[model samples]
Target chain A: MDFKLKIWRQKNRDDRGRFVDYEVKNVSPDASFLEMLDILNVDLVKRGEEPVAFDHDCREGICGSCGLVVNGRSHGPGRGIATCELRMRGFKGGETIVAEPWRAKSFPILKDLIVDRTALDRIIAAGGYISSKTGAVPEANSIQVPKPAAEEAMDAASCIGCGACVAACPNSSAMLFVAAKVSHLALLPQGKVERKERVLKMIEQMDKEGFGNCSNNYACEAECPKKISVTHIARLNREFILAEIS
Target chain B: MNKFTALYRSSVGKKIIMSLSGLFLCTFLVVHVVINLFLFKQDGGETYNRYSEFMSSNPFIRTIEIVLFAGLIAHVISGTLVWLKNRASRPVAYEMYQLKDNTTFTSRTPMLTASASLVGFFLVIHLRTFWVPNRFWETAPQSNYDLVAAAFSDPVYSLFYIVALVFLAFHLRHGFQSGFQTLGLSDKQYKWLIDSVAVIFWLFIPLMFAAMPAYFLWFK
Candidate 1:
């Protein structure tokens, strides 16, 4: 198959970005989107042009580094799948694919589709963990976490920190990301001691990092590769309210 | 108050404000439309003109009018702030992509259509007839009815009013359910019911108002 790509390119954070169109031909339908980009980069190298810069560690999609707004959706048109897992078969032959960086103030464009997603790391660092001593490991059965709570916390914990939520959010809010982190620890008994401080600090950090407020549009959930429910946002709100009282 | 500030600081605060203000406005529409229906008087011995006169003289109702303007100002100002803040939250992605149909069209386009309705008719025709003349309330209610008829006589005025009502129908449809959601009333079990009711209210109220002018101008 063949595709025409209008890919966003920029030299640095301050540089004005624009789309540079390129055509890739004879691509395999089974290849991942990143693999297709690799093929295109190979062509660019052969012609003595600068290779397109993008981030991808685990091409299997778990790393969450490979995100793009393909044809105007995070991680392309696939559901519950990351960009690395998205394949060429999703598009028809000779289709013109538009690829751009996520448009969020918090995720500034670094260079050529690469964005600074350090804001997410800052939120996680705020209080996304269980605050405990690093001594001997406690027995697993010591804390009696309800089966449902544990399961739900595990589900919330599944967020891969891909920044897709921010990308898809109309307000560029990181509420989904913050909510996921807050819910993950807040739902478990082990983290309950610090749950109040956890949510408060996380939200403060999110806002300080320049993330926008949630618009309740649910666009973030729709585009999230993990399909993180907005219900977590409700959980986050509840936690925040309780924290304020405390 | 600090707690309130926290709530206001978050997205839910803005949403709550939008929803509450929207619901308030929705109630205003119902009552306003119902009152306007009185203008459909058949010119009997006692009619809408009397109702209008009663409303004009009531001091209690005048106080309510002040509250109504306050609500309008809060609703519009807060709504615009939230909308603009939401807009700036994320930069627009590539514009060529199609939007999903999941959210109501009216919810997405409230400001657009609402502005059109306000600008096209409400600012000029409505103020002129209802607001400009101090007599809107001063004259015994019959003059208000006469003014309504006078305004509806021009096809342009009538057409713009009808167009504005159509937009209000669109606004109210999403505004109703969305308002409930921000008030924390959105639950899975009653979501569909809420949606259906909203659609009905939106359509029925606006149609009732539009029917008044269309009927009065064309028939009576």
Candidate 2:
């Protein structure tokens, strides 16, 4: 298969970026999207041209290091999978795929299709951790959690911290990402100790990071690589209210 | 900033205000629709005029009217602020984007709020025509029914009312469910119920309201 690619290219954060078209021939249908990019980069390097730059670490979807708005979708067309998981078979032989970095005020483009995502890390740093003093490894069964509560907590914990929710959202709201972290901790008994403070600080950080408000659009959930539910956002709202009242 | 002020300044806080005020306004719509339904009674508008008079004269209902106006103002202000902030959050626009899978027409269009805001202009026209004359101005008209009938009989005013009601319907379709979600009332257990009620409210109320102008313009 072959594809004509219109990929956003930039030298640095301050550089004015624009889309540049290139053609790739003889792509394997089984090759992942990132692997196809690897082939393109190799071809570019052999031709003594600057290779297209994109972020990817784990070819597996779990690391959340890889992302691209492939043909106008965050992490390509499929649901519940990252960009690295998208295969060339998803496109036809003569398709023209457009790729770009996450377009948000907070996520500045560092290079071609690579936006700085440290804003998300800053939000997490605000209150995403439980402050438990570590002395020894505690027994796993010692702090028995209810089945439902544990399940809900795990579900919320499924978020891989990818910025796809922001990339896909019209308003660039990070509510789903923040909500995932907030709800993951809020649902657990261990996390309930600082739930009020946690929600407050995390939300404050989220606002300070210049993310938009959630209006129940459900775009984040749809484009989420992890398929994180918007119900977590509801829980985050409940938690924020409880935090405010208390 | 103080915690209260800080909370109100946050995105989630603005959303809470929007939901609370929007839900308050929805209640007012239900009451308004019920009162206006009296227009359909073929009794020469006696029942409708009496009801309108009672609504104006009664102190309790009058006090609630003040709250209703406050709710309207809050909804408009918070909604605008939120919209502006959301726009600023995405300074760069996508060249090629498609939202067919994840979003509904109402959900995707940020202009729904603008449509609702346009209803504000219609509200001013409506109030000047009906509310002002009915409430304060004695020389304008003696009966509330006569005033409403006279206004609705005008093609221009009736057309505006019908158009505004259509926008209001689109606003309510998204606003109803959005209000529940923002208020944390959309739990998994009752999400279906909330969604169903939103669909009914958005569809039924606006159509019923539109029917009033249509009725007076043609049927009556």
Candidate 3:
């Protein structure tokens, strides 16, 4: 198969980037999106041209590293999948695909199709962890987590720290990601100890990061690869209110 | 910043203010629409003027009026802040963003749509045409219906009012459920019910409002 790819290219953070279109021919239908990029990069290298750069690791959608706004939707088209999981068969042979980096004020472009996503790490570092006594591993039955709470916590925990939620957001808000972490831990008994300060500090840090606020458009939910529910956002709001009042 | 200042400055805090003030304004629309319906009574605006008189003179209602304005102010302030900050969050524009693929068409941003810029503009003109003349200019209760009918008489202003009501429908279409989502009450169970009820406020209120002007302009 053959396709036209409009790829973004930049030297570094200070450089102004633009979309440079290229045509790739004779690609396998079964290749993942990243593998297709690899084929293009090999061709570019053979021709003594700079290859397009993007982040990817597991190629299995679990790493949360590979991200792109393909044809306008984050993580390519459809729902519940990452860019790495996108297959060439999803597109027509002669399709013109526009691949752009995640655009957010906080996530600056480090190179072509690569963004500085450390801001997300800073948000997680703010309070996404629970403090527990370091000792022998406790018995599994000791925690006594309820079934519903466990399900909620597990669901929230599925978030892979991917910034697709941010990329897909109209406001570029990280509320969905922050809410996922907040709700996940807040539901567990172990996460209850620092619930109040945790949410407060995390939100303060999120504000300092210069990301936008949630307009409740649910675009983040729509674009999320894990299909992270917006219900966690509601939980985050409830948690914030309870923490403020109590 | 102090605790309250910090809270108010945060995005979540500002949204809390937006939701509360927006819903307050939404409630005000209901009361205003329901009362305005009295204009259609066959008694030639007698009942409409009576309620209008009571609303104007009663100290309690007047006090509530002040609170209502306060809510509007708060809502506008937070909305403006959200729009400004969110605008700053995306300095670079996308070369090809098919927003329709991912999100609904109702103002992709909140304040840009639901939070009121057009509706606010219509409101200033609306109050100048009717409320100001009725309240401060000494247009007595007897002339109240005359005030409304006379204003709706102008084709341009009447058309503008109706156009603005359409935008209000677009506004509330997102605002009603959005307010619930912001309040953290957006449980899956509540969403179906909240969304169902939301259609009424977003549609009914505006249709009822637009009907008045459309009625007076063409039929009356």
* Candidate 3, position B43, lDDT: 90
Tens digits of per-residue lDDT for model 2 on A1-246? 999999999999898889999999999999999999999999999999999999999889999999999988999898999999999998999899999899999898999889999999999999998999856999999888899988988998989998999999988999999999999998887899999998889888888889888867899999999999998999999999888987
Docking class of 2: medium
lDDT by residue (tens digit), candidate 2, B106-195: 776555766777788988998988888877886754688888888889999899899888888878888899898887778889988998
Cα lDDT tens digits, model 1, A62-170, are: 7788888888888888688888998999999999999888878788899998999998998889898886874798888887889988888888888999998887665
Clash counts per candidate, in order, are 1, 0, 0
Show where candidate 1 strays beyond 4 Å. A127-154, A183-201, A234-246, B1-11, B41-47, B50-60, B90-96, B100-104, B109-128, B131-137
Error of 3 at B120 (Å): 0.7
TM-score of chain B of each: 0.84, 0.94, 0.94
Docking class of 1: acceptable
The root-mean-square deviation over C-alpha atoms between each candidate and the true structure, in angstroms, is 3.5, 1.3, 1.5
Query: Quality of candidate 3's docking, in CAPRI categories?
Result: medium
**Each prediction's TM-score against the native?**
0.85, 0.98, 0.97
